[model samples]
Target: MVELSGKSDPFQHSFPNAVFYIPALIVVSAVAFFGYKLYKSLTEKDRKREEKLKAKQAKKKK
Candidate 1:
């Protein structure tokens, strides 16, 4: 491995802002996706419960 001279440190390289923004964007997207999935699951359970109640009420009227 070639060593960089006196003032030049390998770790001192400048990274563009996009490098940092990319990971942040990915994390935000993943969180949003998971949140949506959880919301949909809860709503589905509620819908099923409502259907059962409606069916039971209809049977009582017969």
Candidate 2:
């Protein structure tokens, strides 16, 4: 084994650009989750409105 060793790299302590991607990924995931929730709520509202309309028509027929 070689006994003589040089100094370690100076850039080892400096963070790379890839570290910034972690926060970006979290933000994207949060946006997607909220968007999905919005879509689900809108669809539920439409479904309830349709049900009310159908019940009104049925009552009129009877």
Among the numbered candidates, top lDDT falls to: 1
Model 1: per-residue Cα lDDT over 1-62, one tens digit each: 23334455556445577877889999999999999999999999999999999999999999
Give the Cα-based TM-score of candidate 2 against the true structure.
0.72
lDDT of 2: 0.83
Residue range 1-62, candidate 2, lDDT tens digits: 22233457543344556677889999999999999999999999999999999999999999
Alpha carbon lDDT of residue 43, candidate 1? 100
Return the lDDT, model 1, position 57: 100
What lDDT score goes with residue 12 in model 1? 45
User: Can you tell me which runs of candidate 2 are displaced by over 4 Å?
Assistant: 1-13
Which RMSD does model 1 reach against the true structure? 5.6
Global local distance difference test of model 1: 0.85
